[model samples]
Target chain A: MDLAPYLLLAGLEGLVQASVLMLTALGLSLVFGVMRVVNVAHGEFYMLGALIAWACGAYIPGPPVLGFVAGLLVAPLAVGALAWAADRAVLQKIGYNPEGTIVSTIGMLYILQQGALLTFGPDARAVDAPFYYTIRTPWFGYSSYKLFTVAVAILLVAGLWLLMRKSKVGLLMRATQFDRETALNFGIPVGKVYSAVFAIGAMMAAVAGVLVVPNQQAHYLMGTDPLLLSFVVVIVGGLGSIPGTIAAAVLIGLSDGLLSVFFSPTLAKIVSTLLVALVLIFRPEGLFTVKGRRA
Target chain B: MTKLQVEGLSAFYGQSQALRGLTLELSGGEVLCLLGRNGAGKTTALKAIMGTVPPSSGRLVLDGRELTGLPPQEIPRAGIGYVPQGRRLFTELTVWENLEIGLMTRKTGREALEHALELFPVLRERMQQRSGTLSGGEQTMLAMARAMCLNPSVIMLDEPTEGLMPSAIAGIREAVIRLRSEGVAILLVEQRVDAVLPVADRVAFMDHGEIKAELPIAEVRANPDLLHHYVGIAARPARPATC
Candidate 1:
């Protein structure tokens, strides 16, 4: 048995998983970082994106590319608008109290899940990949679409980094994250920032969902696994650290994929769970904290 | 001339009232120091005027514009700069970003920022560094410089010299004097009479959430007993008292 082929396949699979997980976990981290709100309903937004992509494939005219492109644009915007409305209508009313947010978001989780089940039905729907091209190696052939997903995730991450580091809007978000009262005193509409952050975060997850749907399938219950995995990634990455979130996503995503291929899926989950427990015990501030600043 | 008039400003935290019918005024080119003991509503009045703490029944007017019902975020845009207690700089942001926030609020450009940086020359070097890592004195300068970036007609500093050394305190006093000469109204909240006497044109002694008296700096300097009465601290002598 050639171990090289097996390892190569596992690595490629890991990259795909990591790419999707990176976008999903980044969204979770960004929301918690700025708003300090734990949105348990984040995965529901991901589910919404995938389901919306399925709907587009069925209803939209023209080629698969058109449907995929439509999904890419419509899913995030729709999900983001819904998230913004929910934030204003619900989260803002509660003042974003940590305990209240957790409970309220859990309520949102159920509402969205049930809503998806009703609208999209309880079936697992498959989405056609935009391109049929494949890269053939000596031992096997791989889907080019998977590599496209990785490339797209990287580009989105880079764009997000620029928006955060270089833009005035990013500065306002960071200032609010540092000190809400000070941000308010300096004429930053902190309430508006919170609403926008919440929306942007959900949009990130929604985009990831649309990207991954071609590889997987859209199901109302599909959000559970990604949500759990995302929680693991976010906690391990540090509470509000963006760089940490990305690093953690890659680390866990690759490990889970490799372990599932080599050993067992159950074993992979056990390992990830233990990792989170260890991180919580050893470095509660996270592995990537610098002087208490969430870089 | 620009003036800030805070009339009948009453604020409460839950059932407990922090400010009761607080009234004060500061005209351009003058520094009005608010002197009081701890919990005497000095900070509360500033917060109410800034629109952070909701005023139960009061009016805040800045040069004929009503700021009473405006949001806290709007107050700064209405030309009131506030440096709250503890120099609440956005710790995660760079020094330049903190000043950028102020400049952005006022919609002022690089010229205003240059003017602010000129006041604290040292901040020019540390503009790229995170504000949280700065020394206490440097942090105070950054806070004051940030407040000044907006070119506001009124600036409120709450306990600006609380934890600073003599040199930093002098820098704050100089900045206040410079701002006054530039026709900006200032509200300085201080517990120390020594820090206030040099820069304050007039002092308002606050006790139990109301201004007990507003006296000229000369009158307070002449009557040291007045400081002892309201602020609960005797004016220190020029030299340390011999045991």
Candidate 2:
């Protein structure tokens, strides 16, 4: 067993996993931060993105980049539009009913999953890599495509950080999260912001699907595991905190990566699940929290 | 010109009505005090006028523009500023962020913010501080100052003095007076009748979602019976000692 190759593989894979986890967490965290609803349908949104990517690949012609980009862009936007409509038509009717929101989201998840299976059959489809060329590297014997995936993830996180901190829209988003009524008083157009955030969050989830499609392939049911894993990451990170999400993602990725490397991957999954349960029991607020912020 | 006019404004929270046929008019440069007991619909009137709550069927005109059913954000753009009850500051946002957010909805740039901070200079010092941790009085000032940042024609405050010390309330009164002198129409919903009587030209007493009485401040002051009758607070008549 060559140690160097395994380390390279694990690091590259872990980085990719972290990126997807971060993107998936974005919507879940945003919805929770503002509306206080744990949207169980978030996974369905991811599934929608994957299905879109698969459909794009099936119909479209050209290199993987076009299909991947099409899937990345279109899937999330469609899901976001769906999320927006759901919010206005269904969620708004209940008017912040926690139990109602939860049940509705779960219902949405089932509807979407069944809808995906109906539209695109249950069989998994291979998704070509967006970039197939391999780079000649001495130590890290990985393709350039995988390296690009890692780079893209880093750049996106950086972009998200800058947008959140430096932009006026970000300021309004943070303000609205704190108090929607007060944000409206400031003329922030609270309704529009809610829509934009849901859209953007859905977009992030789709982008994650696009990135992972090359490795994992696309299927009607590929998003379920990511959804569960991201929830664990989000919970460990402390709900709605960006730094918390990334930190928790990295922790989860590294832990699972190392454990799977040492023992069986199935054992690693069991341990991570146990760890999450332990954390929930011991530190209910989360491993890292600056006062939970009420939802 | 009259900045805010409410004709037969009524609001409902589900089946129970909050504001029942409330009518009032406010001209520029006037500070109209809304004095009432708790749950007297003072806040409801302000929320209605600012378009926070939809009036079941009533007329709201602000500077000649009909504003009956506009949303809360639209009302501010229509030149109405509101400081809600409980100082409803975004507890997670910083003081500067809260103030800057007021002008964000407006097409105006940093100039509006500079003007707001210039008026309430204290916020300039505590710009980075989170609003939730601010003292009750400081939060009150922040809320009022944030509303003023919008530079709206009419400024409506819902209980700006609630849960504050005497000095803070006095500071707010002074600010209202200053705002009045500047020709900004002010509607202050307050339980402290004495605190506002000096600056108020007219006072409206409300009970059970209706304005039971409206009179000049002098009339309200001279006849503390009006206060006792509607608001349940008696203005102590200082009796001369018999020599």
**Docking quality (DockQ) for each candidate:** 0.84, 0.60
Off by over 4 Å in 2: A2-12, A93-96, A133-140, A292-295, B236-243
Model 1 ranges with Cα > 4 A deviation: B237-243
Candidate 1: how close is chain B to the reference, as a TM-score? 0.96
What are the candidates' C-alpha RMSDs? 2.5, 3.7
- lDDT by residue for model 1 (A1-295), tens: 5999989988889889998999998999999999999889999999999999988887898889899999999999999999999999999999999999999999999999999888878899999998989999999999999999999999999999998999999999989888898898899998899999999999999999999999999999888888888999989989889999899889988998899899988998999999999989998777766546787
Q: Pick the candidate with the highest DockQ.
A: 1
Q: Model 2 RMSD to the real structure? A: 3.7
Q: Write the per-residue lDDT of candidate 2 for residues B1-243, one digit (tens) a residue.
A: 788898999999999999999999999999888888889899888877766677887898989998777777888888888889898898877897787787666666777677666666777889999888899988988988888878888999887887889778777777887788888999988887666666788999999999988998778778988888888988754222110
- Alpha-carbon TM-score of each model against the true structure: 0.97, 0.90
Model 1 chain A worst lDDT run, 10 consecutive residues: A284-293
- Candidate 1 lDDT, tens digit per residue, B1-243? 649998898999999998999888889999999999898899988888887788999888999998889989999999999999999999888899999999999898888888888889999999899898999999999999999888899999999999899888888788888889999999999998888888888999998899999999889888999998988888875321111
